[model samples]
Every structure is written in C-alpha cells, then in structure tokens.
Target: MVDDDDLILEVAQMSLEVVGGWEVTTANGARDGLVRARAEHPDAIVLDVMMPGMDGPTAAQALKADPETADIPIVLLTAKVQSADRDRFADLPVAGVLAKPFDPMRLPAELGSLLGWT
Candidate 1:
C-alpha cells in the first residue's frame, strides 16, 4: 500500500496484516512507492490518487512502463467518488478503483475481489 497520509498507511497496513493475513509493504509517497514496488514486487498495489509531486495515475504509469513491475495489478484508492473521476483511469492498466475512507475490516475482501484472489 502507498499513501501520503501516515494514519491511512498505518491503518491499512494493520488491517491487511491482521484481517487479511497478507504480508504488506508500504511507501509514503509515489516515488518511494515506485522504488518499493520494484524491489518488493508485491502481488498488487493499493495506491492513493491525490498526493504531492507524483499522483497515483502517474505512479501507475511509471510502474507499468517498467518490465519489472508491468504485470502487477494496481488498484487505485481515491477520495474522488465521482464516476467521471473513476473513468479517467479507463485508459490505464489498473485492476480497479476503490473509494477512500474504506472500512478497514472489509478492505481485504474488497481488494481480494478486485484482484481475483481467493
């Protein structure tokens, strides 16, 4: 998971770890996320849309651009709940888009559904 907000990162990490029983790696920003993504090669990425310097879409592009991370599925997490906002990613190679302020307990289920994980 990658997010600029410390609280979100912590909550998400804990939620995924405890509830989902998934090993999660996190980065605070898009640049760090790219680096981590390359090194760790996580099964999927939970990326935040709004951030300083590099946004989620740009980061997803960078991830897809490199062969090392190209195949990894990306699920965008955003505060923008509008369909138009979600439609912007139709051109990108993303698995799905999830709304922000998500239920911590259900996050794993939602993400798993998106990633087609049992």
Candidate 2:
C-alpha cells in the first residue's frame, strides 16, 4: 500500500494484515512505492491518487512502463469519488479505483474481487 498519510498507512496495514490475512508492504509516497514495488514484487499494489511528487496515475504509468513491474495489478485509492473525478483516472493503467475513507475490514474483499482473487 502507498499513501502520504501515516495514519492511513498504519490503519490499512493492520486491516490488510489482520482482517484480510494478507502480507502487506507499505510505501510513504509514489517514489518509495515504485522502489518497493520493484523490490517486493507483491501480488498487487494499492496506490494513493493525491500524493506529492508523482501521483498514483503517474506512478501507475511508470509501473506499467517498466518490464519488471509491468504485470503487477494496481488499484488506485482516491478521495475523489465523483464521476468526473473518477473519470479523470479512467485512462490510467490500473486494475480498479477504490474510494478513500474505505471500510477497512472490507478493503481486502473488495480488492480481491476486483482482481478476481478467490
């Protein structure tokens, strides 16, 4: 998971680990997220849309452009939920877009469904 907010990261980490029963690695921003995604090669990536220095869509482009990390599915987390706001990211190379202030416990299930996970 990648987000600028420490509280979001902490809560997401716990939710993913405990409730979702998934191994999670978090990055504080898009740059760190790229590095970690390259190194960790996790099953999926959860990215924040409004981060500083390389936002989620840009990061997703970078990930898609790189051969090493190109195959990893990206799910964007954004505070912008309006249709117009969501449409802004429609062209991005991401698996799905999830809203912020999410139900922490349901996050994994929702993400899994998006990715066709059992």
Candidate 3:
C-alpha cells in the first residue's frame, strides 16, 4: 500500500496481514511506492490518488507502461469520489478503486474481490 498518511498505511498493513493473511509492504509516497513495487512486485498494489511527487494516476501509467510491471494489478484508494474521477480512471490499466475513509474490516475482502483472489 502507498499513502502519505502513516496511520492509513499502518492500518492497511495490519488489516491485510492479520485478517487477509497476506504479506504487505507499504510506502509513504508515490515515488517510494513505485520503487518498492518495482523491486518487490507485490501481488496487488493499493495506491492513494493524492501524494507528493507522482500522483496515483501518473504512477499507474508509468507502471503500466513498463512491461515488467504491466501485468500487476493496481487498485486506487482515494478521497476523489466524484463521477468524473471514476470516469477518468476508466481507461487506465487499474483493477479498480476503493474510496477513501474505507471500512478497514472490509478492505481485505474488497481487494480480494478486485484481484479475483479466492
């Protein structure tokens, strides 16, 4: 997961680890997240839309542009919950979006569904 907020990252990490039984690595910003994602190649990425240096859409584009990371699924998590915002991501190579202030309890399930994980 990549988020500027440490609290969100921590909560997501805990939820995915404890509840989802998944190994998670978190980065505080989009740049770091991209670096980590490149190195680690996680099963799925949960990215925040707003961040310092390289927002989620731009980062997602870069990741998709790269053949090595192109197949990895990206799920955007953001507060930009507008109709246009949803439409903006329609053509992007994202798996889905999860709105901000999400229920921590259901995050794992949401991600699982998005990634088609059983």
Q: Judging by lDDT against the true structure, name the best candidate.
A: 1
- Candidate 1 per-residue lDDT, tens place, 33-108, comes to 9999999999999999998999999999999999999999999999997879967977878999989899999999
How do the candidates rank by lDDT, highest first?
Answer: 1, 2, 3
Poorest lDDT segment (10 consecutive residues) of candidate 2:
85-94
TM-score of every prediction relative to native: 0.97, 0.97, 0.95
Against the unseen true structure, what C-alpha lDDT does each candidate score? 0.94, 0.92, 0.90
lDDT of 2 by residue, 2-117 (tens): 99999999999998899899999999999999999999899999999999888989999999999999999999999998999878888888989888899998988988887889
Q: Over all chains combined, what TM-score does candidate 2 have?
A: 0.97
Q: Once model 1 is optimally superposed onto the true structure by TM-score, how far is the C-alpha of residue 47 displaced, in angstroms?
A: 0.6
Model 3 spans with C-alpha error above 4 angstroms: none
Question: Which of the two, 2 or 3, has more TM-score?
Answer: 2
Error of 2 at 4 (Å): 0.7
Task: Give the per-residue lDDT digits (tens) of candidate 3, residues 1-118.
Answer: 9999999999999999999889999999988988888899988899999888889999899888888788889999999989999999887789999988888888899999988896
Whole-model lDDT, candidate 2?
0.92
Q: TM-score of predicted model 1?
A: 0.97
- lDDT-better candidate, 1 vs 2: 1
lDDT over C-alpha atoms for residue 11 of model 2: 91
